[model samples]
Target: MLQHSAILGGGMGGMLAAFALAPHAEAVTVVEQDAFAGEPVPRRGAPQARHTHALVSGGARAMEALVPGVLAELAAAGAQHINLPGRYLGLASRGWFPRYAGRQFILGCSRELLESTLRGRLRELPNVTVLGRTEVVGLQGSPAGITGVRTGSAPLTAELVVDATGRRSRAPRWLTELGFPPVRESIVDPGIFYATRVFRAPVDAGPEFPAVTLQSSPRREPGVRRNGTLLPIEDGLWMITLSGGPGSRPGTDAEGFRAFAALLPHPVLAELIEAATPVGTPFGFRADANRRRHFERLRPCPNGFVALGDAYATFNPVYGHGMSAAALSALALRTEFERRRKPGTLRLQRAVAGAAANAWDMATGQDARYPGTAGPGPGRFDGIIDRLGDWISASSGRSRLVTDIRADIFALTAPPSRMRSPRVLWQAVRGGDNGPALPDPPFTAAERRVLGVRPR
Candidate 1:
């Protein structure tokens, strides 16, 4: 039986892991390197927090069920609730997609605020302890089993160690230190880079603005690379992110960013930021890749430990799969923990890693669609998936059949198989007119002035 659990990070995955274990273990401690204080400010500890982060409805439900009152707390703290299909306006390589009502929704807020709220609730649990300012440097025990984690400042022993250390995790090295071979790994990197800036909202169109995205059209005659997004976060602010991968890179300067946004398929991103009050300098981040460790395939796995979130797999942040995958992983952990209550069982460890397979496949599978996506080429089935995704994107603008397929895909509620349904096939073949090409988003007259678009 597991008497205690030690989590080796304080990010979303780490925090969720603590929550999952708190109910099963006699005690749970989260060893975090940074101190959580002040009004949820960004820290160097979480680089992605500085970028735009949102919770899909699937993740939101999982988190709310794991950490009580999370949704209420987030809403009270200024997170915007957005209906997924009905409220989102996106420009894809094919064309603009018509917004349709769907069963799922998304919550938009700064990553810091979401973490701080969850941290606060978690700290209140009697069996959980937040070991603030504590850095975990290594693992304790042999490859047969992990007894505990050895930290930089202080070494603590526990029955189980959970690594939720995000992308820069030392788990692999630590495993190697214990005599285990390198975990089976896969990498599909598009070599994406990001430049983002926060601006005060020019208009009170919070709910109406509809999170706008202009996606890259790589499958076109001449492959192209570029994408832009405008997300409405907390405090009457909007976060605009411009990204390019491989040979394409967004500029670091403010004027350059604005100019780049202006060139995207739609003028929404540039228009939204043109006249808005700039609140912060543009932040840049690179090395965003899709990598995964297939721990489930190992013949003999270490006991008393498992890696989740970015530590286990990292998706290209451009797709916004990080948090959703983390939530799914946490649920997987809970399922495995419930299956085998024994703490130091290698069987249980293997099972936990096995549970993350679906999420890992989902993230890397689609990231492979980008042109010049550097990595191993996909198998025949993967090629079909990519082409079908493009087909659905082209047909979704007009056909309700494609709309259902799209809603299922984007909502993260269904597997890729949803696109193959006979209903979708019939509609794609018969409904030749996939509706008229979508127009520019419903921007107010003021928004037109901001982008300097002449009256049409």
Candidate 2:
């Protein structure tokens, strides 16, 4: 029997869900409320799309497989490709992270470009149909099972309903309406605020000029909290953002934005902005914190229903892991669809959630280090691991091994256990041979000159 699938939301998750299920589902429909023009225009559904987002190698791989020529299309459309450590300069709680030979890379582009491309390509899939300007009001099913979704003035029936409606998902409410209890949820809000400005690229250094990042140090500057990042996107444009957490917050005004970046652990962002020509007004976004819904643990999940992407979980955007996590979640669902031809299978749900759990635990566990981070605080074990992670990344300025392990974790390609490998743990505990320490992220001589910083 052919099964019809209804996907709520049409962003990355919704589109990916449609891509994953289209092969198995008899018909795939994506219900999106925002107007989509088959081109990347700002939408109300994804406010955070204005900030810096990276398509990590792990997620990139999944996206490529799901939609052939996606990477090529993005590259053709002006996506910047960066390799970890090599093309990424990072600051940790300790100090500068050493640039190492990278195995994987990240695609840096506008959220608009990413979504536009994904939506455009998915439209070509014969089995996938996008229902724009439509909202999912509720679910049509019982507490034990989901049968379909209820849109305004329309009851769309489907054998399976996948909720990819992002952080604002009404799945819990819809389920409750169907006589089911609320799904258990966890939230950790460090009160993060982001302000981003786009500027014409300072210079064309190709890949030599890496992505610049000044990470927030939770323990070092106890009372002061500020961080900034400068990412090169397509065309000659740079997406610069200043982020503040907990007590500290980035400003909405342009002058204050530069001042905020200037006060970061480094002045690179401030310097760069001062030299580059601003393209437009700065964009800002603020959300409570990292939150995830535990739909897997529910006693009964309908056979034909599944949840993917932000609908299942959302992490702090500061980490830049949300896209990667969504890609991985989509892959899990795709893998299940390939193996199991039927919907509502417990094994499939468990497998997909279990796969998603790794990304959730790593993101939330590390974020818990913040003083007032929302979810569970780090216990003794978590604390130990956190300290070790800090030590390795901090000391990575001197050790290549530490840099490699750190890059792998950041890219979402390697599990958290990679850091605890006997090989890495041994050197981590003993502190390996020291090399030329990078006091701070190295900016090219030209970049420094452009930013008005004297070359080192």
Candidate 3:
């Protein structure tokens, strides 16, 4: 077991990492720059928390494994465990999805609630220390490998240092200062801005109201692609997020937010938001770029340091995979530590890095098609993959077997490559589901009554 370990960042990823490392280490320290409030509220450090965040199945399971019973805590806090495909009116690029039923699900709640729940659960662990309101300035060891971290007052030495500092991570610069080579990185920016508003859910909207998702097709004509997602969060409120690139970026005004939603691939999101009474002012966020730091590719990756979560990779939030990927990486950290019974092992870093591979592919593959996407475009083989993805998305709505597999891939329970498998490819080729595409939002009669959506 490790003598001691330090996690830099007290966000969900950092806290989850501490949970993972706790059983394998004598003591765990989670350092963060912001002091969390006693109640579940968004912190100044996590601006993205104001927007809607989804806890996909992959992430939910990982979070449960590391911090048991937290799901019940979230539910008790008013978060809805909305089933995926089953309780979702998802509009894909090809067509609307027929509500599917299976094992996959996501937690619909504010990021602050998720973080607060984690913070609460973490308090129960006596061996863990949450050092908040402290800034991490730099690294303390040589490039040979990190030995400790430098904070504002004193350096905290640990057998292992994990950087979960998020997208703004300074690990690369800190390593360079330690005499290491520059860390290579890849970024794909869709120039998209997200605008979100909380609505007082329709009076009759029950706890089981299906989540609504509108997806944009990036493979079409080169122009602004718009998308929207509305889900039932805590407090009997619905959080609606509308997204668009460049000129089409969602506006700050309430009218513009609804307009953006209306302009999406479909009008269901727009219609619902139009009828629901808004609880608060509309807000916006723009740091949704997908960035990846090639830490694993670093020769003999720093012996005592590791990076996970947004520090290692970030995805377009619209894809709703960031938290899940982070949780998976944390789970990987625990698995590695238990197996090796040590810190900073080569296997650990690689495992953590590999955990984000599927999310990276899914984010970049879709974002690269945007007209003004920053950096390089998709690989030559991406076109083929896109075609296969479209077929799967279209067929899943009609085929239960195909739908189950597709749902797993999106939920992160299954690798995206599974869709490319020979058997899956054969299924796609032969067309698994046989039926006409859904022509409109597939809302059940009960759901229609709740949302005031008129039946066809």
Candidate 4:
């Protein structure tokens, strides 16, 4: 077991690292630059917490495994555990996805609630310590391996150090300062900006269930791709998120937000907003590019050091995969520690990085397709993959078999090879021959009554 380990940042990812490491080390310490109250309120440090976040199935299961009963705890605290496709309506550029039975689900809650739960859970771990209001100055050791970190007063030295300090992490320069070569970065900026508003979901809006989503195609006229989603979150609330890129972002005003929603490819989201009462002022943004550091590629990764979450990679918030990927990465870290008592950081780094593979690919793939996206574009080989992907999207709404496989892949629970299975390939070949996509969201009479929308 490690003598001691330090994790920089007390943000969501950092807290997760503390959980992952608590069992593997004698003691774990988390350092945060900001002060926060015990309540589940927005922190000055986590401004993005005001936005919408989806705790996808794979990550949800990982969290449950790590904390054992945390999901139940979250539900008791008002988090919405929603089944995929079954409990939500999805609209792609093609058409609406038919509500089908599926194993995957997403937990809909504000980012604040999730992070607050993590923070509270951290206090339960006897071996973990959180040093709030402490600023991290730099690394304590050389590029050979990090021994710990330097704070404002005393330098903290440990056997291992984890950097979970979100997108604004300074680890690259710190590592270079310690004699490592400059860390190279890969970026795919979709130039996307988004806004979110929480609404007191109308109790009269039918039984609390299935959320709604309307998305524009990246394949649309090479410019701004407007999209909107309305999810029923905890405490009878609907978190509506509208987003796009390469142009004017949706405004935060009540009228402005509703106006933006009405501009979506479908009027479903707009009508729903019109029916509900606004709870708070709308919040906006998520412009950070889908950026990643290929630390795994660094031959002989520093022995006592690694990065997780946004420090390792930060995907566009629109995909809502960041929190889930971070949870999975912590799980990977624990798995590595279990297999070997004294594991090398290089392989361990690879394991942590692997957890993010599915999310990274999905976010980068979608972002690249948008017009005016920065960094890399889809390559020539990707052209074939895009066609296959489009085929899957079009068929997913109709074919249960296809939809299940697609969800598995999307939820990061299955490998990409699942799509290449004989059944899937056959479905792809059959294409739209199966028939028309769901022309309208498959809502029941009760749901239709609540949303006050007629069938298209």
Per-residue lDDT of 89-141 in model 4, one digit per residue for the tens? 88865777767678898898878888788778888899998888899989977
Clash pairs for candidate 2? 188-374, 201-236, 303-344
lDDT of 1: 0.75
Ranking by TM-score: 3, 4, 2, 1
lDDT of 3 by residue, 345-401 (tens): 577778987899888987787788777788797789877877777776655446666
Writing each residue's lDDT as its tens digit, candidate 2 over 270-378 gives 7777767788889888864678787877666655667778888888777787777777777787887776666445665676677566677776776677775666677
Off by over 4 Å in 1: 204-207, 220-222, 343-359, 432-434, 442-456
Candidate 4 vs. true structure, TM-score: 0.95
Give all candidates' CA lDDT scores: 0.75, 0.78, 0.83, 0.82
**lDDT score for residue 261 of model 4:** 89
Q: Which residues of candidate 4, in runs, are more than 4 Å off?
A: 220-222, 395-397, 431-435, 452-456
Candidate 4 overall lDDT versus native: 0.82
lDDT over C-alpha atoms for residue 100 of model 1: 64
In order, how many clashes per candidate? 1, 3, 1, 1
Cα displacement (Å) at residue 365, model 2: 1.8
Please write out the lDDT profile of model 1 over residues 1-456, one tens digit for every residue: 468889999899999988888889899999999885546887878987878886877678878878878898898888877676566767655666666676777788899888889878887889998888889999998867789999887788888888899988888888888888887788888888898888776654544556777877656434566888878877887788898877777877888888878777677787777657778799888955788876655546777777888887887877676787787778767767787766345554555455455455665676566667888877878877668766755654567557655555655566666777777766666643556546666344644454543222
Candidate 3 displacement at residue 88 in angstroms: 0.8
> How high is each candidate's TM-score?
0.92, 0.94, 0.95, 0.95
